[model samples]
Target: IVGIDAAIFMHPTTWKASGHVDNFNDPMIDNKDSKKRYRVDHLIEEYAAALSAEGKENEAAALLASMETLLAKDDFTGLKKMIDDNKMQCAVSHTCNWTEIRQFNLMFSTEFGTAVSSEEGNNIVYLRPETAQGIFVNFLNVQKTGRLKIPFGIAQIGKAFRNEIVARQFVFRMREFEQMEMQFFVRPGTQKEWYEKWKAKRMQWHESLGMPAAKYRFHDHVKLAHYADAACDIEYEFPIGFKELEGIHSRTDFDLQQHQQYSKKKMQYFDNDLNPETGKPYGNYIPYVIETSIGLDRMFLAVISQAYEEQDLSLPAGEAGTEEKKDSRVVLKLPPVLAPIKLAVLPLTKKDGLPAIAEEIIQACKPHFRCFYEEKDSIGKRYRRMDALGTPYCVTVDHQTKEDQT
Candidate 1:
């Protein structure tokens, strides 16, 4: 019920201790034939998935095994060999001649305090690639200061940056984006139950946004992060295909435990309640974490793409027309609440105060919702334009508006 602006800054060493500084690096490989760089992990994963889909399981398994070795050592040459051995081509460049794999740090680096050069102080700081760390670093502070009970979650929506080598597929994968992340603190033994609960709740959020449940699916991760005991992605059907829109992870106490060990901070919670479940005093224990992370941009894209439609709409007869016919229309069937325009006030004719009436109506409704006033085109044309933009309704102010009502 209460909220405060918490000026919580993360400890720099938290990144180092979490193995973020070391393990957060992406294996990047360039296509020698096309001069395009790509994330090697993503490239190989895509290759494996495609091959498996094509019923080439043996080839995919071999390629995946080789990719694993290549990733472990950051070996570009080995990656190239695997690509050639598996006949895997770069999805972007569509070339098989891939350059050697190299580690690319996705973190955007900056210096704090002084104008120190990389050679001098080398005071390089990273813009967070993920918001989970921020919540992890503040675990003890929020627990003690906020007086939050166990199983309570700290929710945050913040900007995160990842230096993507190939920032394609529109907003689905962006270099800079907003993340709504929540880290739920729970007793160590009960992490699985909470993880499942969050996964269900997160999927419900997507459904609540009006996307069909059939268009969204849960993809359980066979290969989980080092910190994650379990992980799953909420994938939405995009224009291209189904892709990840959000991630739900059971991170356990890996983040807090790592930060505690690295920063020498004691991150522990005590359960005072007599064991209704265990009948024992819950000793000082590192709370396990259930994390739900969602990308706002991805959600926006899913909504936009899902709402976009091109169909033939029925039109009434006009001059010289005998029967009603289908008119080619590109309409965005956007949900009213999310539509860019709520209503448009159109004048059938620009003369005889018709436009004035429209302008007045537009001005009246402008404060309430987005409205468009147009007099340059015919009423039908104006209505079509508004419809194309997904305007929910169009109010035409013609001579009828000026006539006295009985």
Candidate 2:
């Protein structure tokens, strides 16, 4: 299927059709003294971790269990009580002066066009909070136009915005970020199989990066979302902790059905294949969707963290001198396909046709992949710089190349 780039701004009613208007919210609370707000789950998680750090293992576990229970029940009063009972304090206030937990909408809103008259109502617009909705709205159009068959996918990479109250951990959780999302359409009962397939495939893709296997684990969602029948996260062990790097969800026709209801449009597919049981064509039905959504910035941070290395080139303990004891280099050992710069052309010296040879090689190879040519620094220093930039290959031009054309 052709890739899609969804518009960042859609009709205001688009969100309402997608259920973001009524349900896409985070529970947040503020400190009365400092007026600092925090997402309820983040606050509770931080407090629970602190409890475990203080060696209160059982207490932390119980607190987390209760918090989850309260959250599932939507018992905001009990949630606030739990926070107050545990004496969770704000980072700024240092006191347990907390206000009641309230639901906060995460979508950022804006006005679209200027009104020409006083009678004109405000033309409110919203930045899309997720790319999946865009995919849902366009699924039928692409499926019929491209003649895509069942089990086909529509993938997109686009920016999304959220008014995150507790946006922290750098790019892990940001107000504005990009997402790479794919929604696979399939028969209603087959979504589970497809969901599992994508879970394994996505994990395999991450493992192929050659990072340690111990650093990744699948975290199945204990509480499914409003639209998801099954969901799980591909979590990577970042410096902060094992956070979600990608998500795989089985969304069972909720998105398409909602849009159909709101827009009065038929979002159904006509399957001509005969159903074995009834010996009749399965016709006119909404398809189940299996979605794999990867956070682009989070994946970038994860790759960078995994590729960075501090290598020790010092001699062996028994066989070497102490002069080279501290010899080391910092390198970004990125894979060739993913590295930003693929090749570096270095000249051994500024003269003797060496720099000219490097430039010739650069001209020959520049079209295929990114190339960097340098003669300002020593060869060793230039190599180090290329390593730091994560260039996977370095071609050094010297007098030997001029002699033998090697």
Candidate 3:
């Protein structure tokens, strides 16, 4: 449950052995006429969302299924046909003639040594693209040193890079972003049970955030990854549509086994006592891993989208006033826990010591929470400004406050 910085310099070997060195990439295609590069998956997802918005849910579902099938099969022709049939226009180009998808490496390359005397071993280094490798590499070290029991998990929140071809939809898929991930260690034969537990736990975590249950769905992966026995994504309904925000995978010792073979090291745990039910040496076995990974940026974006609102806030009391004079305002309506600025201090008047009082209040509250003080324009304008910035509370200092008995 505790968060720690997973420092670099400890995971390069893990990345290399995990096929991340070769496979941590996305297929990007460019429109010849538009000179814009796009990640094919993103483009298709946008098209799907648009179809749904137009009340064409059946068409949207069919298009999404077809796209998934084509992507899994790597059938470029079929993918293009799906896009054409759906009238998928490039957000960048607004045209249908997109280029054939090409692989784009996500890892960023760097050199370790001097450019002049760089020898064969000194040339290439890559910025770690994913933080999962760090957890995988440290699995045995943590268990042995921290004395962590099996069935416990290591949770990490760290930066990862993807060199996204199309970094759009605000912060959904950025080139550099943060990830919150947990890798749970379990007995080899009992991974299925643990996997189900972790899946429920992860879903509960999302539900605790207070988003609608209907807007989130479990998408079981039809095609499994190299390491996964079973996997499912907790897809959230974004402003765009339902898409993956978090993934839960049952990785059955593939990571530890790969690293052990590649590094020439044994990664196994020993147990002193035997299980009476099974009655065998409970010793020296690589634990199966159940992983729950969520992209922080995507989760933040989903929260913002869900919380953003435009509503008629005019009270019935305001009906007595003219339509132009009626009090109606657009409010961000962000949850208090996630509001960027929790409080805003406004001076009722610029002159008469109100500004000074507001400043004093700001100084007092800044140590406790994020706050803003303003004396510009009218009090109503300042409140409106704070509302636009998603400030949850606005406090105005007035002449009455300056005359406090205390």
Candidate closer to the true structure by lDDT (higher is better), 1 or 3: 3
State the lDDT of candidate 2 residue by residue for 1-406, as single tens digits: 4677777888777799889988999999999999999999999999988988999989989988888788878899999988888889998989999989999999998877666535543577899999988888888889989988787899999899999887888788999999999999999898989998999998898888767789999988877788999999999999987989999999999999999999999999999989898999988799999999999999999988888998888877565764445578989989787899998998899999998888889999989988888898789999999888899999998899999988
lDDT of candidate model 1 versus the reference: 0.79
Evaluated at residue 28, the lDDT of candidate 1 is 79
- TM-score of every candidate: 0.76, 0.90, 0.78
Which has the higher lDDT value, candidate number 1 or candidate number 2? 2
Clashing pairs in 1: 76-100, 76-101
> Candidate 2: TM-score?
0.90
* Highest TM-score model number: 2
Better of 2 and 3 by lDDT: 2
Cα error of candidate 2 at position 147, Å: 1.3
Quote the lDDT for 300 in model 3. 86
Pull out the clashing pairs in model 2.
none
Q: Write the per-residue lDDT of candidate 1 for residues 69-141, one digit (tens) a residue.
A: 6565656777767767777786566768867667777777676776656586356567788777887777777
TM-score leaderboard ranking: 2, 3, 1
The C-alpha stretches of model 1 lying farther than 4 A from their native spots are 1-11, 32-35, 41-81, 89-102, 115-122, 277-283, 310-329, 340-378, 394-406
